[model samples]
Target chain A: MNFDLVAQLAISGLVIGSLYALLGVSFGLVYQTSKIFHLAGAIPFAAAGYAAVWAAKSLQLSIWLSIFIGLAAAVIIGVLILVLGYFPLIKKKATLLSLFLISLGLSVAFPNLLQIVFGVDNLPLEVYDAEGNPAVPFANPTYASGFLTITKLNIVQVVSSWLLVIAVLYTIKKTALGRSITALRTNPAMASAVGINNKVVYLVVFSVSSFLMGVAGILITLQFVANPTMGLQWTLIGFIAVFFGGITSLGGSALGGLILGLLSSLSGIWLGSQYAPIVTFAILFLTLLIRPQGLFGKEAI
Target chain B: MKTTNLILNASNINGGYGKHQVLRDVNINVGAGEIVGICGHNGAGKTTLLKSIFGIQPLTSGEVVFKDKDVTGFNTSKVTALGMSFTPSDRPLFRDLTIVENLQLGAHIVKDRSLIADRIAEVMEIFPILAERRNLLAGRLSGGQQRQLSLGMALMVQPSVMLLDEPSLGISPAVVEKTFEIIKDLAARKGMSVLLVEQNVRAMVKITDRVYVLRNGEIVLEESGDDSRKRTDWWQLF
Candidate 1:
C-alpha cells in the first residue's frame, strides 16, 4: 500500500534480480550447449569465493589480485570438473541423467570438502592496518534519492552483471561463436556436420559458464563474506531461475530472475520476509502449472 | 577398380542406434562431381547410410574412404573438416541465426575468416533470395528458403562432397522442385559431389547421376539416372 516502501523494495529487487540473472546465464549457457544440468556449477561458485578469501588472507594479496586469482581458479576448476568428471562420461555417450547425477554428487561433495578444510565459519577476507579495524578496497558507498538509499557496491554489482549478460547476449547475437552455440543448441548433429568441434565447444562453454559463476561468487563474497556452503543456496536459486526463465533462453532467464526477485522482495516487505520462500515456491508452482515454457522460452521448462 | 574418381566410398557399413541394426553392410559411393541419390521409404536406412559416411553414426564394421583416405571411425566434425559437409533433414539451419550467420557456421571448418566471408558471398550469390534475407533469421524464412539456406550453409564449406538427407523433407512440392534444381546447379557449377538421401524418389532420381534404391537395410537396386527416368515401374525395385 505504501509507495515509498514499494520503491525501496523494487530497488533491492532489481539488484538481486541482476545478480540472479548473471547466475542464471552461467547455469543456462552450459545446459544449452551440453544439456548437462551442471549441478557442479556450485563447485566453482563456492571455490572462487574461498579462493579469493584464501588469496587475500593467506597469500597476502590485494583485493584485485585476489579476485583475479579467484576468477582464474573458477575457470580452471570449472573446466577441470568437466574434463575429469563429465567428459569421460560424455565420451562414453552417457545419458544426461548420468551427467546430472555426477554433477550433483560433485556439487554435494565439494561444499562438505570446503567445510572440512575451511571450517564451519564464514571466511570473511578483511584486510587491516595497525588499528586492525578493516581495510576494504571499496566500502558500501551509498547513492540516495528522495527517501530511497542505494550503495555504490550495489551499483557496481548491478551494472557489471547486466553489462556482462548483455555482452554475452550481443556475442550470441552478432558473433560467429554465438552462432555456433546456437547451432549446437538447436541441432548438435547438424553442428558437427558443419565442423563445429563438439569437444572444443564443450570446453569453451564450461569455461565461460564457470567464469560467470566465479565472478558471481567473488562479487557476492566481497559484499557479504563467503562461507563454505553459500554456493549450494545460490546454485539452487540459479537452477530455479534457469527453469523459471525458460531453460533454453538467456533473456528468458534474466527476465525470470527479475520476476523472481521482485516477487520475493515484495513478499519480504508485506509478508514480513518469512514468506519470501513461499512466494518463490508459489511462482515456481504456478509457472509449472500454467506456462512452463516461461516468458520468452521457446520450449517447456 | 578405379577408386580415384570416388570422393566418398563407404562399404560394408553395418550400424544402427543400438541393438537394432538399421544399416546392414550398406555400400554406397559418390564419384567426383557426381550427384548420387539413395531412395527408400521412411525407416529403410537411407538416412543411416548417410550418417555412417559422415561418421556421426558409428559403424559396427566398415571402411569409409573419403578422397581415398581411410576415414572410418572419424567424428562428424573431422569428416566435415576433411572437405565433407552434411545437411540433415530436420532443422538443418540454426533457426535462430541469420542466413549469413548460418552460412558462416557452415564454413566452420575453414580456418581463414576471409575465406569464410568469401564463401558466404558465394553462397548468397548462388541463392540470391538468401542474400536479400541474409540478415533475417533462418527460422523466419519460408520452408523453401530454409532449405536453400541449409544447402547454402553446407556449400559455404566448399566441400569436395556433401551428404544431404532429404533437402525437401518438409517443404511444399514447388519448393521440392526448386530445391532439386538448385542441388543440380550447385553440383554442376561447383563440381561438388553429393550423396543425397530422399523419400521423394521421383525428384531425386531426375537430378542424380546414379540411383541406389535401399530396401530394409541394404541396397536393393542400382541404376543410372537415365535408366531410372526411363523406368515408369520403379516401385518394383524395392
Candidate 2:
C-alpha cells in the first residue's frame, strides 16, 4: 500500500473538511433561524477572500489585520443586504421563493461585479512577517507519526474548527440568545407573541453567519488562492452539507461537512481528483432518497 | 359592559388575510381580573379576533385600547413588550424546545435572568407535570401535557392580560376539564385578566365571567356567564 499517498490524501481531506464544516455550520445557523435559504451567502464568502487580498497588498497591513478588514467588509455587506433587500419583502410577507430568488440574483451579480473590478486573475494574499517578508506558510512546524504527517495549518484548521463548533453549540444550546433563536425557528408568530424580536434575531444570525463565512473564506484563501468564482462551488457544497447533516442541528452540519470531506478525499484516491464532485452529489442523492430529513433533522425537508 | 374598569378594548376590528375579510367591525373587551370567553363554532373569526387583539394580525380598521392607550396596529413583539401574550390553538408551545426552555422563552420580554427563573418556578408550581418533565422536549409530551405546558408558558411572563385562542384544542375531555379549572384558579390567584376563545360553550361558560357567542364572523349573543349557563337554547346559535 502507498502509505505516503494515503497520508497526503487524508491530511488534505481534513483541511478541506474543516473549512467545509465551518461553512456548513455558518449556513445552518442562518437557515435554521430565519428560514431564508440564503443561497447568496456565496457573495460574502468570495468577496471576503478578495477583500483580504486587496487589503494585504494595497493597504500593506499584516496578514491578521487584512483578514480583520476582510471580515468587517463581509459583515457590512451582509447587513446592507438585510436592510436593502430582505426587510422590505419580509414586511410585505413575501414567500420564501421570492427571498431565494432575490438572494440568488445578488449572489450571481456581486461576484461577477467583483471580477470586473479586480480582474479575472486568482489573487493570492501574502502573509508578511515583522521584517516585511512574505511569510513562508511552509515554515509551519510539522509533526509526524507512523505514516501520517501534520502541519501547523492543518492542526489550526482542525482544532479551531472544533473549538468554534463547540462554542457555537454551547451558545445555542445553553445561552438565552440561542434559546430565543430556537423559539423563533420553531414558531415565529408565537415567538413574537412571547416578545422575541424576529428582526433582532435575524440580524444576529446574519452577522454571525457572515463572520463565519469570512473566516472560512480567508482560511481557504491562505491554503489556496482567492478568485471571484471560488464561492459558487463552495456555496453548493455548503448546502449539500446542510441537507446531508440535517438542517435543524448545528452539530449535524459540522459532522456532515467532515464526512463529506473524507468521502471526497477517499474518492479522489480511489478514482481521480476529477471524480470528487461526483461523490458529493451521490451521497446527497442517497441521503435524500433514504432519509430526506437528514441525519439529525427532526422533520423532512 | 361598563367602560370604566376595562383593561383591553378592541373596537370595530375589520381585517383578514389579503381581501378575505374574516373579521368585520367586531368589538371585544376584557375587564381587569375578569375571565372573558369568546365561544364560537370553527371558522367563526374567533382566532382572527384574538390575532388582531394580540397584534398578530394587522387590522385595516379598528382601535385597540389597552391600559387606556389606543394601540391600533402594533405588531406582536411591541404588543408583547407592552404586556400582552397570545397562545394559539395549534402548537401553542415550541415543540422542539424543552419544557423549561419553552417557559424561559415565555419571559423573553423580561431581561433579568433571576426574575425569569422565579417565573418558571412559579408557573411549574401551578402545572407540576411541567416540573416533572421540564428537561424533556415539549413535542415528546402527551397531547394533554403539551397543552398544560402551553398555558404554563404563558404564565411565565406574569402578564396583566393573556389572549388564548383555544383551551380544549388537541387534548382529551378529561384534560380539558382540568385545564379550565386551572384557568379559573390561575386568574383568581394571579389577578390577570384572560381573553379566551373556545369551541366548548358549556366548559367556557362554566369558568368565565362573561361569554360572547360568535357565529358567521360576528358576535350574535353576549351574556353574563351565569345567564349563558342558564340559557336553554344555547346550541341554537351554532
The best candidate by TM-score is: 2
Q: Please give the CA lDDT of all the candidate structures.
A: 0.85, 0.85
Q: On a 0 to 100 scale, what is the lDDT of residue B40 in model 2?
A: 71
TM-score each candidate: 0.90, 0.94
State the weakest 10-residue window (summed lDDT) of model 2 chain A.
Answer: A130-139
For candidate 1, the clash count comes to 0
Judge the docking of candidate 2 as incorrect, acceptable, medium or high: medium
Q: Residue-wise lDDT of candidate 2 within B1-238, one digit each (tens)?
A: 5635999998888988897988887888889999999977778899989988887788889899998888777877777777788898888889889998899888878889999899898888888888999899999999889888888888877778989888798888888888899888988998999999998877888899998877877878788888988977867787
Q: Pairs clashing in candidate 2?
A: none
Error of 1 at B225 (Å): 3.0
Across B34-85, the per-residue lDDT of candidate 1 in tens digits comes to 9988887778998888888888888899899998799999987788878898
Q: Write the per-residue lDDT of candidate 2 for residues A1-301, one digit (tens) a residue.
A: 6868787888878887888888899899988988998988887888788889988888888777888999998888887788789999999989999999999899888878988999889888886666777763433788878777787768877887777878888889999899988888889877877877788988888988888888888777777789888877787798898899988788999988888898899777678999989999999999999999889876777
What is the C-alpha local distance difference test score of candidate 1?
0.85
| Per-residue lDDT of model 1, residues A118-180, tens digit only | 899987866555555566556556778888988877888789889889988887777778878
| Best by the DockQ measure | 2
